[model samples]
Target: MSITTYGLQHIKKETQHLSQEQLSELLLRLARYKKENKELLAYLLFEAHDEAAFIEKVKGEAGFMFSQLSALSYHAAKGMRKILRLLSKYTKFAGSKEVEIELLLSFCVNYLEYADRRTTYKPIRLILTRQVEKVRGLIGKLHEDLQFDYLESYNNLLDDAEKKLIWFKKNDYQL
Candidate 1:
């Protein structure tokens, strides 16, 4: 990610709204991490903490406790945990009932891939793509640029992933 110079102050200045810079940084981080074959644990501690902090910030802003988050976030996270368990993976990560990048990625790569792309589907796909960096948007909501840049990258990744899914399907190739 190009978020080389971000911190709490930067976080406090941005918004949940979408912008270019935010998206670049988020997508960069994601692509680099994925290309490097790095697990979420491979990211810096501050980054993870920053992410969790943003989630907490959103929850705080919405005054929505973990128990009150959308069923999508809750159930999907649980489903991801089941996958992790089946994979025999072990980590000291947070509870599986809340938002986590692994769960979000799994949801994107697994379930969301099946939906046909169209006018009605963009928003949810956008939400899924943005979900990973939604923390950045949340932080950005509290920061300077006002609109969140992360959304741009998230949307692009979602779009790219969607396109690849379509192509692969047409070609009878498995993702």
Candidate 2:
């Protein structure tokens, strides 16, 4: 049989009664048992108070992830997938649409700049296109000013990708 979950108020009250040491131990225990808990704890401790800094930190991480992509055609797509997964995890922890859009934009930029479509598989192109579409949808949900800002960035990314594609086609898909 499943146990009924306590209400948030009840849980908060119970948590407030714990001593500092007890709270620390409880947090450690929660983090140890689940990856999501660990990420949540990390955000609480390190990222939540400074969203802009956190976004910059994750963008740098994404750049590093992109840099690690293999030159070999076969491994490149797998590496891109791994980078995308890490970005998703970071975006989830940030818990903001702005962060999500920023990370996805970084992914698109990296995919265009670093990924060799001529050498890599078609699935990687599909993955990048899907993320671009997702980012567009997310931009529509933001406030008008923010949406305009992000839409401009999104357009630039697409333009760069298109330029690269045209160059690749003219060059007979050699990058």
**How close is every model to the real structure, measured as TM-score?**
0.24, 0.82
Total clashing residue pairs per candidate? 19, 0
**Which sections of candidate 1 miss by over 4 Å?**
1-93, 96-99, 135-162, 165-175
lDDT of 1 by residue, 1-175 (tens): 5747788776656635658888667656766755332444443333455656644543343232223333454454454334435322212344332244333433344434333443243444444444445433343444344234334533545555647554322122111
Worst-scoring 10-residue span by lDDT in model 2: 166-175
List where candidate 2 sits over 4 angstroms from the true fold: 1-22, 167-175
Compared with the true structure, what per-residue lDDT tens digits does model 2 show for residues 74-116?
A: 6887888888888888888877899999999988888888888
> How many residue pairs clash in model 1?
19
